[model samples]
Target: MDTHIYTADDLDAAAKDIVEGKLVSFPTETVYGLGADATNEDAVKKVYAAKGRPSDNPLIVHVDSEEMVEEYAMPLSDEAKSLIKTFWPGPLTIIFNLKDNVLSKTVTGGLDTAAFRNPNNDLTLSLIKKAGVPIVGPSANTSGKPSPTIAMHVYHDLKGKIAGILDDGECQFGVESTVLDMSTDQPAILRPGAISAEQIQEVIHKPVLDERVHVADAQVPKAPGMKYKHYAPSAQVYIVDSPKDFEEAAKWAAEQDDKVGVMATDAVLNNLHFSNNVESFSLGSDVLSASHSLFAGLRHFDNESDVKSILAQGFSNDGIGEAYMNRLNKSAGQKHFNK
Candidate 1:
């Protein structure tokens, strides 16, 4: 299939494709999401096939309003009500028990519960409202690769495989939404993202279970990125834990047989002098900027075939830093700098 990028002026056409059960990639505040009408099983299966995503990993249902949630899901809890009031139309995905035979097994991964969110992007909300159906959305990229924050990144991975890309430029958060399971008595966080657990706890007046710990098990994941290896670039990534480690890491990279790439903050890059073979991408000034640049930087080096190793920066896992490190650690395969 030839993929055409649809602009804001042409969103009705994009919605038309989605309504007809064709795969369309759309923008979200978090990342670009591959969209298909959740009511259409064939459309949902094509999403898994296009991205090579495992069938058991469920997709998030993106909708335009809370009424849409009530239409398909079981009654929402008091806490779920509070959370939606606080963080709806943003980067928080909540899991709710499904009404019998409401959504396809292909969309929910055969689970009784489904994850749902309303992204803050206006283009996406308009598209969902225009299509007049809830859409199942996973990140728009090949499975196990960095999530696409820009529309071109989606094109690079899924050009001919999908119908069209709803291009609204670079994503704001540059990461996926936090997946929270509210089906249980206590809310559990399935995946960490821009919305921290502490933020969720404050809104609900309760502690959120950090279930990011149970990810490596054999059980089927309740959400995407839980049971799969994600955000991995083609090159080997070594995470430098501290500014002190970068000096030694540079020396080590100088001795390597192939070219090296560096993903670091402006301060760290200014102080270090790498060999000519080393190419660098700035992670901006701090952790917030680092989160925004993480996937783009990794993709930057993927274009440079000569870069066999990437020495990337790491920050203290707090606030949004937790989400940043979670993706960085996966990309680096938990390998840290010691040289």
Candidate 2:
């Protein structure tokens, strides 16, 4: 298939692709999502094939409005309604009990529930409305690689594997949505993202279960990023837990035969004097900035031929920092600086 790149001027063609059962990646607040009509089984299957994603891992359905979500995944609790009102048209993805046979098994992974989101990007919102159906969207990169935060990243990983890509520039959140499973009586977060657990609790006025509960959650997962190897790059990534450890980490990186990549805040990157073998990507000035740039930094290292390892800086696991570490930990396989 010829992979066409779409811009704001050519969004109609992108929308048309989605309606015609073809794959077109669309931008969201979090990341570029591989879009297929959720109601079309064949179209939805193409997404899994394109990304090499596991069928059992499921996909998040992106809608233009609440009606689309309610139409397929219904019986929303009052809390669910509150969350939607507060965070929809943004990065939050909610899992609800699905109406039987409303969405294809390809979308729901044959589970009784489905994940849904109303993305914050204006171009994608227009595309969803134009397509006239919710779209099944997983990150537009190959399965188990860093999620594409830019359209070029999608084109790099998925060009020729899918139909086309809608270029809306960089994503705001630079990560995937917070996956909240409201399918059960006790609500729990299946994954962390820009939307923090504290924010969710603030909205619902109740203590909702967060990703910590998933350590003991052995049940079938209702969201993506669980039971799957995701966001890994070609280079082995290790987390440096303290700024003081940066020197040791740098020394270790310098000793490696192949060039090593370093991802850290401006404070660290600016002070570091690098050997010729070091490739550095900045994580901006703080944790919030780090969350916005983490995946891009991973992809940056992934694109470098000589990079064999990436030493990423760590942050306090609180607020949005928790979200940043969640993804970083996964990519690093929980490997930390022991030196």
Candidate 3:
């Protein structure tokens, strides 16, 4: 199946297809998203079917403007307004009370609150505006898989499964957006992304919730992408603390005759010594840089013919690093060393 790379001019036509209940994959600043008309139950259902996403997981409504988000979500608090003013057209998602006239339960997953964002990409923003309704979108990959950063990743995972893909090169953030629930008096972060929780708190002048809480399936989810095991790679991945531990593990992997892939920070990449079959990739100098390349790096090694096992370097659990570490831990699945 051919994945069409749409230019800005084609956004209107693509938006038309989405408005007609077809699935369209478009770029957000963080990652490419599989989008459908948020107000149409049938259209929103197509997103779940196409991505094999769990129906109960809910979806984030992508709007072109902050004003557009207000139409669907009623009574946005002053905190929500402040955050939107500072972070809209960027990688931040806010959860607010659902307006009475909002039509689709599928978009909210039967919840009273919904996640909404104004993405930073021009094509996506224009498409949402052209569609004349919010677009329900999540990362353009099957559930539990690493989020797609490039058009090919989407085509690789979702090719025959979805109707159309709007290739916009690689995603800038290569991760999901920071999700904050503003329905309550104090802002709460349901998920972390490129935007940090501390940053949101600074803007809103209140503490934000960063931990996960159990919710009933019958209720609407406060945030999308919160309930699932996400950002996983195909092969088993192990995240280690430092270069010394990674080197020790490499030796162990070599002795066991298992092909290993090492994802390291730039500081450690050049120092690691491994066999010809042991592949290595660098995550750059800082945590933010690593966050931007984490998924793509995982995809790179996941596709390598010689890779059987993966050893990933752990990052500090601060700022955007928190989100990067969360994805790494999820990808690792098991402990660093199997006993």
- Which candidate leads the pack in TM-score? 1
Estimated TM-score for each candidate: 0.98, 0.96, 0.93
Quote the lDDT for 266 in model 1. Answer: 98
lDDT of 1 by residue, 212-307 (tens): 864556687888887777899998999999988999999998898899999999999999999988999999999999999999999888854568
Please count the clashing residue pairs in each candidate, in the order shown.
0, 0, 1
In model 1, the runs with Cα more than 4 Å from the true position are: 214-217
Residue range with the least summed lDDT across 10 consecutive positions in model 3: 212-221
Model 3 scores a TM of: 0.93
Per-residue error at 158 for model 3, in Å?
Answer: 1.3
Q: Residue 84 error for model 1, in Å?
A: 0.6
TM-score ranking, high to low: 1, 2, 3
lDDT of 3 by residue, 1-339 (tens): 444656676776687788788888998889889988887898888889888888878788899887888787786777778888999899998888887857577787777888888999987888887889888889898878888898888878887767678767778888889888787776777777888887887897877876555456565456765566677777788888766686687676677566778888877877767776677888898788889999998888765445777888887788888888877887786357632
Scored by CA lDDT, what does every candidate get? 0.92, 0.88, 0.80
Question: Who is ahead in lDDT, 1 or 2?
Answer: 1
What is the full ranking by lDDT, best candidate first?
A: 1, 2, 3
Q: What range of 10 consecutive residues in model 1 has the weakest lDDT sum?
A: 211-220
